[model samples]
Target: MIREKSKERLVISEFFKPFLRILQIFSCYSPVPASSTAYKMYSVVEVTLLIFVPCFLKTVDVLQSFTELDEALATLLIYVTFFIYTLKSISLITQKDDVRKLVRCLDLDIFQPRNTRQRNFIKGQILTSKGILTLFTAGGCFTCTLLDLQPLLINRQERNGPINFWYPVVNTTKSPAYEIAYAYESIVSITHAFTHCVLDAINIICMAFIIGQLHSIEDTLINLRSYAEKEVNIKGEPNTTEKIHVQMNILLIECVSKHRALRRFANDLNKIYTNNFFLILANCMLALAFLMYKMSKAATLDFTFIFMIFYFGTMMTLVFMCNWYGNEIIYKSGNLHTAAYSMDWPGTPISFQKNLLFTIIHLQVPIKLYALNFFLLCLESYISVVKTSWSYFVMLTTVSNN
Candidate 1:
């Protein structure tokens, strides 16, 4: 029965499992449900459409002189951003086995909630973050769909398709063909939104789990100190002192091992996602700038303007969440050294103190998430991104005026 319970905790909770399914559908990768040949086939087809369709349509638009320079640039930004996502998805699929191992490491029973308080806290955090992401994604999809269909609904007299998709039909502006194109574009837009949401959620959840690990480590250190205090306070025989010392040393060793494992887990995650994060950072800046320019130049409150606003907001929120949680990891990790220092060390022998000192020094560096080993993911980097986006926006505006 104990073994069964341990296995159960090792599995992801039912509440969070659907997110994994969505990720698999969109990215062709999942930590659970391990990838198979069928999955690979499906992923290749889905990713090819997701990446190629937009680029093909935009290329046609540019060749046909169907869009202004600003509009074309904005469309190109979407194509490039989704291309980056495709590359990341390919990386994730290729490294699916390693990702599975990382997920399993995180799912170990030792990391599971030990009491009601902890269980509630973990569930609350997971639910809140998941709920927020789900709601935002739904809203974005709705907005995108509305934007796509608004023209059809608002203008019954004029027959025009929603998106500028390249159809094989020579005259797509006709009734049935136009409607078909509109429906196709709407579906594609929603699927694109769903893809973005799932990918971003995967990164967010990983950071949340790491933060939970940091909390667990801090709690273990506290419990170790309490155990040592109790051992010292108890009025025992003289020989008990050496035994208590030995017990404390054993506990410290276990703590150190756990800490080392956590560090390794973090490093592995960084290695897997670093390039993806860098791509997100680069895409966010360009998308924000292009979108802002298009929105500013718009003369009327059309679907495109409203959609751009939501799109811009979504990008900003994603960037902020990534940096916020990443900074939290760094902050929580730095506290591990403090936790070590606060332990009941004075009563212990010098050899034990040396071990603790080594642990402290090792932890002082703090765990950080970096993008391609060049840009660190933190609130400061987020601020810089916003500043850079603004600078680009200004430059674009100045050139447009001239």
Candidate 2:
């Protein structure tokens, strides 16, 4: 158990080690799904076989019946959804440790109130970097959903011609029945896409934070290690005080060393969040789009299929979000531990960090990598926008051709 008391006479080990240990718990999980590594391989194999067997049967059973077709399709959706979901889970485990190690590397102390300016700087960096990124991704997902669903609704209105049938539900006619019947379903699809997108965005936001945290950790560790090595060489003669100093220096070094490995695990967690979240959203939308175009094309009077997709989507999203939050609590707690461990250096004023950025850019951040990743992420997002634009253009062309 790690304590978060300011008055607590700053035990650096108590603070840093415990929290770090707790965080590693999330990073180390095998992608294979079971608690045991021995059966882990078997678990993956079993899942693969199970999914494959059904898919194989489906291939053979394609001509069986609509029931078979429906079941097979749903199974495929489930398989893809869970498979990607697992990868995301694994990635997050890896990302969070990367962050923790980087932080341990920087060795920021949450328990010590020293370095007020530096503390604020790092805090600002975290909020703006991760928080803002999260918000941006969330907004983008929402906008995409609205735009995608608009086409569906517009098409519904076009094919149906008029809203007259809905006006006379009790005395309905097939003439305008198709459009009116699907209204409910279309509304559902719109809501479902909207819901799923938000969740997906949130997942990405988590990853972005994990990335930022990693940057912070790495900066701290490198500087502290260099400072420790310099101390031993400076102290010349072998005496009791020098020996004690050496031992403490070694302890600090070990903390950074041990932390490096554990933090890598933390970073893995963030990666999982980014990849899994997007995959979930994309897969769900694809499945919904297919159903809307196929099964709901005729007999359906309103948008029932869209609604079902949205309804299930909202429920699933909440479940995944809760899972992420559960894991993060361990990470934040671990960080608190690392901060306590670094408090042993009483002479080192915490304020040394505000100058840290000016003192050393590498320790402050890998600006080159930051710029590269940020640009790459933005480019990927832009590509999606372009793809959507082209898709819209093609649809317009085909409609004109028809």
Candidate 3:
């Protein structure tokens, strides 16, 4: 058991090395115990001061900007984004144990590929996850850079910080205060981007892994008969038929067990992230709406236009990925019943046939992830989000014109 556990840890660590490194840097994942002072201090500094405080001030600014429609919308975008950052940070800190449980729940024994073919599939999925994460991080940094440089693009007299924060005591409109505020906002803003990327990476990568496992199960079921035949042929026993039936039963049982484990993992994931998903969907809708309206008013070559473009594109990708993986899970799991039916069970023993029937019935319903039990995280929800954003944008434009 110890050896098996050690191997599991090793495999998981190697698989997630890149993501884990970035997560640690942001204090989202720590090697040390969560109860340790060092870990607590690091998390506090990274999350409380950097995320919560800024988000609070940004919320204040969002309320204050209400008097001016354009200003309010602009500040509201940042506020929405920062709100997500704050929620993500707080969740990470407060639900430390739950997060750990989620991580460990990806039991290597269940997820690890048994064959070279499955191994190659898993490898490709890992590479794809890493590539997506890298792109997300790079894009986030690039967006932050564009935002931090926004004030520089304008005249010095009109200069302001990237964030429209309502500082408690400091008069940030003056020369030195303005510069200080700009620097602080830039740092926090960049950190927010990184935190966003890291959390999304964790969720999306997990979903990717689940999708890969589902594919492996499907493949196994589809090829179950051939696999059993090969095993029987290799043995060359007197009771070849009985051996084949036994082998089929064994493989079928393993697949059923793995599938159930995958379902449990998916449920745990939904519990951990459903609230966050609700917030993300809500925020993205408002942000994308206002961003579109604002971009329409700005000159094509202006800094504001360019900045909104980057921000808009980033949000689109984030929303798309969340829904895409979710939809993939549903689609893949939905195919499991078909795969089981495809298994050449016609000639098998009545016992084997009965087991296959049970498995098929169990897999009838496709697996799904949801937001507050209202929004199913799939392409359909993606379309709904986009449409809602468009409606909000239209409303804003009408209100502004009046």
Candidate 4:
């Protein structure tokens, strides 16, 4: 048993290593590596670029004569989203202890997959979702970077850098200064993309873990009848009715406790991510609206139009994944009551039957992920967001045309 437990832990750790490495780079308090002097130095530099570059650009937009208000607002939205994620990462770091405690609570033998089929199913689900999201993120970053550098590559005499910012130097177009600024912007952009990808990946991973737990619980409940029978038998001798009753009562008590613990785990997980999910949903909707407006205004074959389409698609896909997985948790949890009902409870003691009845009633409500307790994260909410964004975009386009 000990060896199997150790192996299970090792396998889980191996599965999480890639995400943990990414988290360590972007988060100060991740368990993979705690804060060090070098990490702090790197954090300082990254944070500065993330926060200052956007502010500088906004300021330049305000000062420049030909700057478009909508474009400036779009840029501001992007930076604000980044800023919110940065703060979210810092908040997660401070709650590392709580996160560790939650994980420990979930580290139960019952949660492990029971067979090769179950194990492979969980592995495949996680890998396939992560792979798709990673590919989309990487592709978006590549396309955006290429577009940003298109001016410099196509027109050698182009004076403007890839991104517009208010530099202290007067001759930002000249050599040395231009090269330095270009390098700085490129580094900042790439780092920002990396941070975005890591944070998004972490969200998906958390959802996957929750879904896995739900699956484990379902499996345990499905086999509870045989487990109870085994508990009542002693040394190949059939137990008395009273003895079986007592043993079954004990088994039901343990199952109830496990159920409560799983609920608490889900609640803690929800609390940690509630605000972050809310912000992501809210920001994605606004960005989608803005992107639609930009796309509608751009020429048919313009680079801006093409880029907006890709950006919009990425945002929609991400929001959909989050909602889809969140809804799955609710869907699977709702089935637990049915599983409990299906258990072979005939001829059981009245007390055992009562306990099973209570379990059924409790699970009817189903566990859910909520955003700030205001909106439940589900497919319905995802659909509403899409509709709202489109309505907003249409309104903006109508006003612009007039």
Best-matching candidate per TM-score: 3
Tell me how far candidate 4 lies from the true structure as C-alpha RMSD in angstroms. Answer: 3.7
Across 277-345, the per-residue lDDT of candidate 4 in tens digits comes to 787788788888878777776788666567667777778877888898889888988898887788777
TM-score of 2: 0.34
Candidate 2 Cα RMSD (Å): 13.9
All models: lDDT?
0.72, 0.38, 0.81, 0.68
What lDDT score is found at residue 87 in candidate 4?
60
Give the per-residue lDDT of model 2 (tens digit) for 181-273: 445334333333333333243333333344444433433443453434444445543544445445445534443443444345344433444
Off by over 4 Å in 2: 1-122, 129-183, 201-206, 225-251, 254-261, 267-402
lDDT sort, best first: 3, 1, 4, 2
lDDT of 2: 0.38
Better of 1 and 4 by lDDT: 1
Better candidate number, 2 or 4, judged by lDDT: 4
Candidate 4: what lDDT? 0.68
Report the lDDT tens digits of candidate 3 across residue range 114-211: 56666566567767977977787888878988888888887657767887689888888887988889999999888788778877777788788888
- Candidate 1 per-residue lDDT over residues 1-402, each given as its tens digit: 011122235344455467667767776566555568887777777767765675577567656653566656755656655566666667776777776677667666556653344455555656667877887688667766766776767665666554566665567778677777777777777777777667667667777777766776676566665564454555353546676677677767766776677788789888888887888788888888888888888656777677777778878877888898899999999899898888767878899888888888887888899988889999999999999999998998987788
Backbone clash pairs in model 3 (N, Cα, C under 3 Å; residues 3+ apart or in different chains), count: 0
**Of 1 and 3, the candidate ranking higher by TM-score:** 3
How displaced is residue 358 in candidate 4, in Å?
1.5
* Model 1 poorest ten-residue lDDT run: 1-10
Cand. 3 Cα-lDDT: 0.81
